[model samples]
Target: MYKRAQYQIITERLKESRHFLQVVLGPRQVGKTTVIKQVVNDLMF
Candidate 1:
């Protein structure tokens, strides 16, 4: 599975709407997109 170290932190910030936008970036298959997608998915629940 895709993973990273900072997903939780970024996800938390997203919940708060503390920023206008959150950008996830990294090498392919490295979990940058995964983190944001996870955040979005989690928010729906």
Candidate 2:
């Protein structure tokens, strides 16, 4: 399985205890949803 740089970045930020908005910016079809799903899955499970 391959993971993008954004995956690690997002995952790290999500682990933070502080509260803030994390906005992901990128062009279309760049697996934004995929990365988000991966982050959620790893953190939740």
Give the candidate number with the greatest TM-score: 2
| lDDT string, candidate 2, 1-45, tens digits | 688889998888877999679998889999998998888888888
In candidate 1, which residue ranges exceed 4 Å CA deviation? Answer: 1-3
By summed lDDT, the worst window of 10 consecutive residues in model 1 runs over 17-26
TM-score of each: 0.61, 0.85
Give the per-residue lDDT digits (tens) of candidate 1, residues 1-45. Answer: 544568678767776845657666678887676677776777788
RMSD of each: 2.4, 0.9
So what's the TM-score on candidate 1?
A: 0.61
Model 2 residue 39 lDDT score: 83
